[model samples]
Target chain A: MSDLEEYKTVIGLSFGNQNSSISFTKDGKTECLANEEGDRQIPAIFSYQGSEEYHGVQAYGQLVRNSHNTILNFRDMLGKSSEDVTDKKHKRSAKPISVNGQPGFSVTVVDPETGAETTSKKTVYEFTVRHLNRLFESARDFLGKKLDGCVIAVPSDFSEKQIEMLSKASKEAGVPAMQFVKESAAQILALMYSDSALVDKFVVVADFGATRSEVSVASIKSGIITILSNEQDLHLGGEQLTEVLVNFFAKEFEKKHKINPLTNRRAIAKLHAQCEITKRILSNNTTASAAIDSLVDGIDFHSNINRLRFELAGSSIFNKMSDLVVKAVKKAGLETVDINEVILAGGASHSPKLTSLMWSVFPEQTVIRSSASSATPLAVNPAELAAVGAGVQASLIAEFDADEIAGSLTPDVVNAPHLTKPIGINEGDNFVVVFDIETALPAQKSIECVAPAEGGAYIPIYEGERSIKVTTVEADADESDFSEEEEPEEIRERVVTPGTLLATVNIADVAPKAKVEVILHLDAEGKLTVTARPKDGKGSNVRGSN
Target chain B: MSAGKSIPLFPSKTAIEASFVPHAKVSKPVVRSVEPIGPYFLAHARRLKYGRTFSEDER
Candidate 1:
């Protein structure tokens, strides 16, 4: 066995709507390799010249050309309703999606065994896992050896339930265990690792990728980093930067080549990619040039963009993010003086315009613009920052070499089951006023309201999504869900009071989407008694003694 | 004691059966006389006589 294969290497996987990548780490140093042939990325591009499957770097290289059939950026569909995706990923969309069915983007996958066609409706979670699993095999092949545990990077907004599904997929991939790390957190760790000196102070790490531009404020205290707030997006990133470059090349072509290259998808795909790389290089450099297209018989097209002018062309893009940075700074409760450093971390964060903008924004602070740590450095090419963080998380997993690992952390890490205190507030349609806490009383008050449903009623006292908007308090008022049998000829007058709340029982919004029960009691002497129990009536309730 | 007591309005079981149960037997055909009833319906009636029976002793 090779020395590199002697020690089992952990793999870090990052799957996104726009891109996917994997990194292998050994002895703590990571090499972010291209996941081609479905190794952390898609190699199969379905088109006329048979099926062109470009693995890893090649797949990324063919992104714009095969974007018509290449499905990326369905990351948002991980645990969401289908209605949310049809509006976005509709080109290769073969079927109408809905939330009630399985979640995520619907994609076509031909069974290898039978060659039968099938549309696999994978939830965002499923798609991410499937991609990760496919990448693992490719990674294993690349390594020419058996695989080890994995560290999977999850979106910052992914809830625990989605994490649970990801963990299950990893288990099926024969990865003994997996760890969940946030993209921003991993990127932050990767940046800190690559650029050594930024550990002393609070820095603003900006990430710009194909889909979105996000800014986050974080502080590294004694090498232990803390992310203060969630990421902010201006909805502008390298994709727009590429689009800007494409438009520039298109407009310049009409001026110089006298032909529109946008008419052909393949030709446009090849050139748009060249433009995307040129735009990224212009972020930090003076100028970059690329061949545009061919005109009449012998003429070849070339375009050169100056850094200063290209920045001007995408000025609105930079301007859109200015407020977001200010907002993030405000939310972080840090002033420009308080910000000791600024580090660029994403693909577009390498843009010279953005770098100069960062320098201008924080003239008082030290700004470190390092290229090594940016996640998708150039052309969204090989970068291991997210993968490195995932590897670090994987190393922390207890089952590095265990033959039979016990109690996989993957399940608990992603979907830690929690029991919400069953919200047991008496929630029959009738207001069963056991004791009104609203009444300012030395002596407690008790009033009984009618049953919600007419009949010898059964009230469940439901436990989720309940918040009562108290328009005005009614001291002696009862207006609730009507039952046909509870009909009285005349409506009773209700006296309205200030601060009287109309309460509906509901559950706490958390993983498990739990139901809670709140049981309050009143002593004959008018002291309030309380008990908190589970929705299943299996636990003790909280009692208010005083 | 008053809540727990069971009523025994009729004096004897034989007299009650002769008066009420036999009358039900006699009026059974009379009640069905209004309908175009089938004999198979009588084969599987609500109160059966031939098989395993239930009594107060069983209760």
Candidate 2:
């Protein structure tokens, strides 16, 4: 700790898709670190105006006039491949593009000297690296010295590759000692510091952000918090609700003026900005009015929408969210009665409808807790909760004894499976386990499987519990299987299983391969990868990328 | 600790102010670079509270 004391200029950062924040501890108190704008939360926005690149709130002001040059919400696309996003429609103002075979965005900017517009393609990774570099530089300037490293809070569902990318970006920013802090765990730490009563409780935590929502059930006992289950909807969040509002207002404007504002990019961008403001205003007021001057072709658009109308328009999304909550609770294997409290933490948690829905869902829980300060009567602004909590976690790491901080801030798993799914190899009538449940993480095992005598070996690897679906092969069942009485084909009536056929190991050779060694490796983050090799070493074998 | 020629890292008053002044004016008085309560001192003081013997690798 004496050597650790020499490098104490690290900051805690919460890099969000729509907004970002930083905080640091000084004189035994954690405070939100302000950006160049002197604001606690900076808009996670950036743009290239002429030849100069701008970031944070400064870039947000360029959205209206230079919408094409501004990039926002790139964080949501991180760790995704170009093909995964090619078919989906983007709702953001920035134009999504395949940048050199990667999922990225194209920004068209005018050259400052020539006054000619040119388009540049940037991957989400590149933008993120630039943003982090700028953030680190600002922190260094503010501290008036070099920093040790910073701790970043990330979504629970963020993949290992995404974390890897973030660390890579931090290194590009010249901050090399960075570590990840789970966002939910950081929030739990903040609560523990403020309130001691939460120690012995089963709490459901919901972090509703701009582009997605993650729900988890956590058990806290003796000041240690453990995540029981985590679930998320990647496509649902406050942005969806804002889209609903934008579409509603656009339709209303179109109906009266015989012109659709959505067709115009600038009009849609301006309307989006207004819709966001109206959405926040509607949270407190029964009715909110939206007006955009020269919204489309010199036509002014104005509409007054009430809370009921807004909620009704977004009811389907709300229902989907309710279903997600139910799914999460079911996965956690806990009934509503067993939940001791509901903890909502995020910018979108301020919505009355969301809060009321949680209350209705968990009626047994008398008090709904949030990341509010228990010492002070006033609630901690929901947007700053993750940042504040991350700041505390960083403080613990920097100053407290490693033993005391490690167990509380980082999860202490006892016999936790590396994969969420139960993995087994096919054995004639049933599947046999290479690694059993409660195997603790980062486990590896090899199983010898034989190839069929004549042809290629088809060794099936299955995940999750096996169940047989024996539908009687009755005559003329195709149309009957598509009965209106049953669920729509898209939504399967029953979960088909032999568990999931995760992979089928096969030899690509013309002849049969014998005595194949199928190796499975499960990493620390509960993710699996596979490698297969034949004992004879004559044929190519199939493998699964992690 | 040998005597050597010294040069200011921040030569201008404006540069010094920009380096030390926080983006937002905190309710607490801002610490000046010349003061004992600079960023280095403040962070150093906080680190001492844990009261642990440190290893070189721990740094």
Candidate 3:
């Protein structure tokens, strides 16, 4: 039998810090496989009630009643020593403990047969193994096959040790991890495969996750994807936004009931859970309400918040997210106008306010993909993009031999040196780039330019650096007398500063209104060559290399 | 065990045996054979062919 036919049951696994999902390609369509609870996005929590273990939504329910036994947010603690765990205060769930120099949790478990409860110290690696085993079992039961392998989606910032730990855990769970794909690259793959017209575009992936917000700038040329820059803020995420609502409602409850819900662990946990639902409702509606029965001191707390108020309360975080996107684009040495699309990933990207705020960051031509946007032919569920893309990737490589797969997927094969700054020509005051930054070595580009209508064309090629220029425009004077003190608007424009001149190709005596062909070639050894010749073939062709 | 004393969660013998079970009977074990590569390299290495159409039962 062929490898392709033998590997038909491979799946894609997106193992996130807050949630995880499994997807598989069946009948040429990649879709998420729901767990037994019918939830495609499964909570990454494990709870032990006595001798029985619960996962996903059932485990998530243990947060309120059995917080001491439920283990959540342990994914980030993997591969870290006890001293490496910076945030030791886990108020809502079980606190982390040190077990043999590694991060572990002490949970009380009851023996079903003997009816005796004992504290068990489980390492973070064990939880990862059990969670992955559950996901694998779900796929196995659904597909009715033993299994082939899987491609796992990982965040861009995951350290090598963390990845190694995850790989070991997966192996222990009896799941063969064929490859690990970056969440950003997986998101772009999902888009490109769905729409053939998405090639050769610059994309900004703004992933507003639960515990962190990550922004990656990727340039897709033909079928190759290059990540230009990545910026992440661990402090900004959905949890922070939920905290705002929690504080808002807590303040309201304190004003009426003369008690602070934040002081009580159970009350804070319940409020945090309900506020998350309220935040989701506010994403789709103008107003939403949060109600917690017996929240604290036998009092039911209820309050309503409109979308405008929610946006106002979280405007700082929203603006910071927008600024992170801009910073990522600037770090890529490109302007917002250069971005062809903005892909919203992660569960928190479902907010309409974030989508609208992103619209203000880029030009009107940029397509923002989110659940809030109007349905288009290429629209995909932002939350499921990474998993679906990983599924597609698994299907693509399932047929290759193990040796071929290992040989191709390596850093040495694709880590070729690339151009750091743009190499282009200065036309009057404007700089026209011929070869953009992040262009892999051994690349060549030919452009046609019109020579100045007189003497020889003195074309000087330069390496350019990008910077933002802020200009203030005065408010119009035709307004009413009451608005005389209106402040002038500041406009930020992307400007390129030409750096060291690489080479100059002097084509003397070009015909008037004639077109000149200029070719730029960059070799793998960082050598640059510029060749220019008149289109009419009646001028001195000059060539220079550096 | 005492309240604060740390003990191994599971037997080390069982853990070692569990890691050696062959999941893929048809293919060689790839988990321990290769090092993990960056996402960009993996994406570039698996670039799709131009004009390749995905059809049902293509595999």
CA lDDT, every prediction?
Answer: 0.48, 0.64, 0.74
lDDT for position A293 in model 2: 93
Write down the lDDT that model 2 would get.
0.64
Ranking by TM-score: 3, 2, 1
Residue A32 of candidate 3: its Cα lDDT?
Answer: 88
Model 3 lDDT tens row, A300-386: 987899999999998898888889999999998788878889998988888788889888887678898877876432366777888
lDDT of 2 at A307: 91
Measured by DockQ, the strongest candidate is: 3
DockQ winner between candidates 1 and 3: 3
RMSD of 1: 24.6
For model 2 chain A, give the 10-residue run with minimal summed lDDT.
Answer: A488-497
Model 3 C-alpha lDDT versus the unseen true structure: 0.74
Provide the lowest-lDDT 10-residue window in model 3 chain A: A192-201
Docking quality band of candidate 1, CAPRI definitions: incorrect
Off by over 4 Å in 1: A1-9, A34-55, A60-67, A86-127, A142-144, A191-200, A255-270, A281-285, A294-300, A372-383, A398-546, B1-59
Candidate 2 clashes between residue pairs 3 or more apart in a chain or in different chains: A1-B54, A2-B54, A418-A526
Q: What DockQ does predicted model 3 obtain?
A: 0.01
